[model samples]
Target chain A: MPEKPSVRAVLLGALPFLAMCFSVPLWDRIDPIVLGMPFNFFWLVLWIPLSSLCLWMAYRVDRHRR
Target chain B: MRSSLLPIGIISAIVLLGSGIGLLAGSRRKMDLEQWTVGGRGFGLILVWLLMAGEVYTTFSFLGASGWAYSRGAPALYILAYITLGYVVSFFILPPIWEMGRKFSLQTQSDFFETRYQSKALAALVSLSSVAFLIPYLEIQIAGLGIIAQISSFDRIGRAPAMIIAVALVAAFVFAGGIRAVAWVSILKDALMIFAALAVGIGVPYIYFGGIGPMFSALAHTRPAHLVMPGATANMGHAWYISTVLLTSLGFYMWPHTFAAAFTARSAAVLRRNAIVMPLYTLSLVFIFFTGFTALLVVPGLANGDLALFTLVRKAFPNWFLGLIGGAGALTAMVPAAILLLTAATLFAKNVYRPLFAPAMSESQIARLARAMVIVLGLLTLYFAIYSSTTLVSLLLLGYAGVTQFFPGIVLGLYSNRVTKSAVFAGLLTGLLTLCFLMFSNHDPFLGINAGFFALCLNFTVTFVLIRGQKKNRLLSIPTTPRSTPK
Candidate 1:
């Protein structure tokens, strides 16, 4: 049987948007550079893998529901 | 200036190699419509990954991406944001779409629309608009080809003639039944693209301003605003950035070609895992951004930003290295063009022509017409490329604004059967007209938000308001009734 995405999964989906989009203004400044890249640019790159991790966790949650 | 044979030579050789592998891979199978269109819907996870990766690394990413970084600065990172967002959204939509495709024996995206809403007319509207939007997209690939050839060959070869020959060559090979084999060629294209991007990304910055870190530090000292939102432009601030990201990410998979590519997967499980892993592809784009940044610092005043990468490569790298980069860029342009041409033509032949014009047309006739449409569409896009050589990024954004009008209908239809076909039809017409007005009237960033996003909001509102007014309420839309199109 099919099921809608769980709250946890949907919220987990939101984490990427939160980090990448919503929090953009907060991290938009290029100060205190991390790992040699600007804070602003580095912040988004940092989220790529983190977003995958979030989605993977979401997938697991989705699978458990199924 | 005299042209060099080396870059053109390398481009020709790689394109030939791509077509060769495309032919070899598909030589074993008969070229039926199903196989021609969706690779028999049998692509496993790895093949789907390659094909999806092919979809990602288009001429837009290859050249236009770096161009944006060169011109726009931090605003270019929206490309990075929206792609990851697309994969996030796809994880939910694709599995369901896949199940529907499997159950209905659906071949194209328009078929999905038709089956869902129980209306051939809706499907025809979809086919018409999607093909219309795809033309500008296909234009960039052809235009990108011309640009790469012109820059790499030192302008000895004009853009128009080069695009004509290259597209004709690819269409001929694809017409001969090598569509599926293009996946194998993608492996080469992706590898070379990554290599070119990394080599330039790391090498250019390092050569001029030390390392990547030092490069940014240098830029911060020289042009501080280029590292943040709005970047070089005053208007494209955080709000503009967020709106564009939302607009594009939602629209990414909505492109008819990308939607069809998702259908090529063997199973829903494959698609779920694909979404989990696909964000990794965006990391390669960061390197492309680095190349563009370095170009901004090193050679600051090229008339066209899209030429940044090619211009830098010509100045910095050896002749053969320039050839290698150009070859990879050529494949990046052509591979995606192959799929777009195929998708648009298939939509035209199967969904539009077969149903609306000739309801009694057989599958074989549809297949034959699709093949002929490929040649016609290729020439048509070539003409557009020659006529208006807009910046690659704007062409895509304009196209995105149009195709993304489908999102309300598709996503809503997935969750509920309550949306009436007339409502979606009305909503699409409204969204397209709003975009046309906003874009043409120079109000694209109306009140600092993306005009496309605004139109999308209006579309949703129209669709929802109209849905409430429908008397029939929820239609059963039973999945078991496959290939049953009620007139």
Candidate 2:
């Protein structure tokens, strides 16, 4: 519909998903607490905001293409 | 149980207030079947957000999330993983599905199948399975309500009566207001739930162990592995975690209610924008997990994992605050129950009944039958909620396994015209039969992968092979356009 979304846009859209699903090995550690939260829990909490940003960026790119 | 009357009274008042708001929303507008089912396709960004969030964060998430965190530990993170990925998947899938819905004036998820594949039998199959899957989902909400009422009232009221009262209230509001009622009530439910979660999650750790850091430190000192994956259990390792997450995320929008919610959006852009923002709602879930972790330290040795969150709240908070949280939890249960019954009833009436038994039925006749079915389904769910004793999370997972089988059918229909109608139908049946066989025989993790994942694989293979065979026959070649006209 919007000229097959750019590969860059598609990759940007998938960043959060890949980061959360595949990077389990990287962020599954419990050491080095961040702001009173466990490192593992903190990683998830951080991505909540970061994923929103990724989606927003993808949305912007798609909107511009349209 | 210190004279729980004050809190019980507060909870009753809150329930009444929510029902009153629901009833008032229905009074101003006249609803046809379309209006009743999807709000005449008039919802904008905010209403869609509240409705989507409302459906996603059910009572199961309210209590079961913390319950999983308290009991299973690291495996509980799967809840967060699946939900975020669900939004990511929605960004790619929902806009096209929403476009199809608008083009066909589709009211239910089953309607899409019927119109897309040009087969009534396929539509009926989808409708039947969706309704069957939705029953357990509804039962969990009804069960959650019973638990909240029992705990908040200090077991003075008992679970059955609490559930019956909830059933009556939900049935009444849904019969009067439909989707609009559910959406408006969600706004209030979302607000109250956020407040309650924040109060319990942050308040419990700070009050008991000085802060979140100390609480985790103490947990690590006592149960070091609890802070990591495989958690308190031995079986849920990396493989189990990845497969389960993938299965549930793919299955997220496959829920009939979630699929139907897309049709309510004002535009495709609204649906897309909502997908981007809906991940923020998972933040509330993080707070719920905090309370669950806190509960592990405060209320140890609970017989049932489902009771963990309530046990912690009753032990830690005052009567007034407990009542407030109970109110939030009750709304959480009721809101989603309303939407489930609405969607299931619509599927039965429009997709199953009208096409099979009463093809000549008028629009008003169908609407009347759907409303009646709502009451019937509500009563059936109430009976199961009172009688069944499974954990909420487990019940939800079983439902997910069944519904996720729809994934291949839906995706292929949207993107590929080469997939024959017969192949889609056969694929769904094969997937469902495999799922039932694996689950009933208690071989859920057959070959160390989730049964649902395996079932999906079998389903796709069958579909692919059948489609290739059909191409050789050259039998009624389907149009290769992205969207085809209805037969």
Candidate 3:
């Protein structure tokens, strides 16, 4: 059987959700359009790729730990 | 032929082709209950991903997200927030649940509850609640399919006939192909949905205002609040946003179809990988939102928010392109509707009817019964779809509030053993009752939080208190070898 994921990896996996959920106040603005998208839209769009990366890292760490 | 008929013809043709593909995919499979409902638990990563994506990006994401953007403004972003956070929750929750499913040969979500709690009453309650909420969910899809058909055909087909046709197609494919058919059809639907979303998302803005930036700039200049949350709405402030996101994220996998779909994964790792990747699918909604935001300017003052996407597409795109978008929209509704019917039928047959009434029913007998239930349930949802006049997004949120009540029981059963069956059962009942009372009484966002959030808090409190109380009782009741303690 594969080993359990480390506490560190599990916590790291949670970062994307924390960033998206609690950072709502920070990114709920319309200024500073990134690549022609509003900040509100850009924040979510940016997190799409970033979330995949975070989960990928989590997957790798969990797999490696196993 | 009229120009509008061109799009209608193309859309009808594509939908028929999709149904044919779905039927053919499951033609050779065995018709056992396991094979029918859970795809024999043999789906690989890609199939699992597609099946999940198919379920996640329903008609709601395609039309309702854009509709909300057009109508409610920034509050619609809660859809994006909940979906991504849902994946985050699933990453932790599903693997263990999948493990339990495989170990115990579980077929449905209620089976997990039944086996874990060792109580048929709990399982029965779960089965009934799932069916109750699922009706509304199925209604959303059926209603969406009807809307797509009527609008895309330029009223050539009326809503009732359109809903009837859509429901019949879903019922036929689900009856013939079961979960395998749903999975296969989802592949086609996902591809078309992505293509359609990209086309409308970018094409509309570019056509109307030269580009996406220009489109947003115009909206900002004219209706800036529409671009941010609590935008133009009074009650849907930050608190509503946070509570909604949290409630939906927690409740995401609680949908019986989503819960049952986890069993179809070939392994736990497949589920883990899917969870990691699924949030990326939310990117599709961004493009969908773009369509909605663009529509706010191009086609202002749509009476029904759900009509926003269709109105914008009809106005901006040509006949052929409109047909493609309509075809995509129809499949989005049909794919999820098939799964919902399948899951509801399985829950009724295996969990409710078999346990409560026909314990002696054989596997094949149950399978036959489930197939029949699919037809019955489909027709019933068709009736509700044609008759009920609730908004699509609110219908979904109502379902979420009810289903999320399953969370306390499921999570406790998964991670802890001390939670008594009575406790879990009471907690679920309380949560569900709270939701019904709040929703029916129009106390949504009661005390600055969504009704669902309050229901969940009450549920967790009841569960925690009961668990601790039970532990204390057990300790006190046990006679602890007092003489041996000295030794």
Candidate 4:
């Protein structure tokens, strides 16, 4: 049980990588501009905060175990 | 030449003002190894956040990021991708590094190796290679500043003289203040850099293309592929993007200055918190991309994409705004150059020189030698900048390729019990030699994948095989789990 939270934390941390990088092709096109940026550019910028939120959740999960 | 006075004068004034802040910050504490190197390891959350963020937002982000976006098209997205992932890796690794740093008074990246692996030879290898790699990195800053100064001055001030003046000013402050000075000056550099990036990011697009959407619309209409992967290149396609992102992110915290910056934080929690919020700083880079994309359309056929920002600014804005932007760009280079010189000097004097050459040297003597090495290194890189013709983006990639080889040793050694000093040493030598062979032989991005990534994988494999081939495990991991500190 002590290590269970870390597994969850690691999974949460991987979320951003999945969104921003691992799935580049799924959203790399310039079509469908969001907030005035091409989809490729917009996807990357959006994931930055999403990445933070993921890490924040990981921190919370790990902290609960601690 | 009358146009040069306003911008040049403004740039000079701001440079002096920043130098003044550095000198005053340096005055707060007496010179010591700890104070000069790691800000006495007392930086709180905000200072630590800026200190780490400041290094990431170097001339690379200011110029190289924009330049690649302009010239290389979608390949530059790798910069944004790698940085965001870099913090994800750091979130797990840096706190452990900081925790160990506090436990054993580890001051440099090489110290982490020396203490962790318990081998002086491995420490020396790490030090020598980091310093060697940092040369190109520091050169980019010096050359980037030189470019900013020369262009912003309307070329009346020659790149050589501009580089000399700016580096000498940087040397004056680093020579006076140490890490505290660098941290204090980060305040100024970050403020101006954020403003300048925002101004250009928004201004160029709005004035020309009516807004960010229209700018991209124009680009998409004109050159549709430029907004997609492998845009404007034979290679650097999706696979290259994926591999390079992996290489850069894994190797991000391995930079000597960055790894050592963790030591300056007061506690591990400070570092973890910093990581939580630092990715938000990458948002500013969105504006830089806007600026670069605008430059691509507005100033077509410009030979050097690195100068896209300056060329566009010079063309569109008034002279005073160029001067202010140039001043911001100058600081964008100097702050990182100061820290790079400091880190490389400390690595050489403390790790390589003391451990390999002068085992009997005291800490005070080593600190003094490190201080002297700062000037020597500053001049050496200045010489390289003046004579060399390497472009800004290539110079950054070259440095990343070499320093990144350290990634395997540092990261694997952090968690794995079987990783041995000898194996890491062997792997580092193999990695560096492979890197040199590949780079000099012009095989980088070999097979549509980053050559450095190839070498890194080989290095990791070598270490893993060696460790697995052996029968022993030393239980080298300091702690198998994060030690929870009370709030």
Give a tens-digit lDDT track for model 3, residues B318-433. Answer: 88888889999999999999999999998888888998888999999999999999999998998888887756447567789989999998887765546678888989988988
Mark the regions of model 4 whose C-alpha exceeds 4 Å error after superposition: A1-5, B391-395, B473-487
| CA error at residue B380 for candidate 1, angstroms | 1.5
Clashing pairs in 2: none
Report clash pairs, candidate 4.
none
Report the poorest 10 consecutive residues by lDDT, candidate 4 chain B: B478-487
> Candidate 3, which segments miss by more than 4 Å at Cα?
A1-5, B391-395, B472-487
Candidate 2 regions off by >4 Å? A1-6, B391-395, B472-487
In candidate 2 the C-alpha lDDT for residue B359 amounts to 97
lDDT score, residue B160, model 2?
95
* lDDT per residue as tens, model 2, A6-54: 5666798778777777778788878888877778788888888788888
Residue-level lDDT tens digits of model 2 in B85-197: 88988887888888788888898989888877888899889999898889889998988898899999898879899899988988888898899999998988999998998
Ranking by lDDT: 4, 2, 3, 1
- Candidate 4 lDDT score relative to the true structure: 0.86
Instruction: Give RMSD (Å) of candidate 1 vs. truth.
Output: 3.3
List the DockQ of the predictions in order: 0.53, 0.49, 0.41, 0.52
C-alpha lDDT of all candidate models, in order: 0.84, 0.86, 0.86, 0.86
List, in the given order, the native-contact fraction of each candidate: 0.56, 0.43, 0.40, 0.60
DockQ of 4: 0.52
Query: What shift in Å separates residue B456 of candidate 2 from its native position after superposition?
Result: 1.3
Q: What's the residue-level lDDT of B43 in candidate 1?
A: 91
State the displacement of the C-alpha of residue B453, model 2, in Å, after optimal TM-score superposition: 1.4
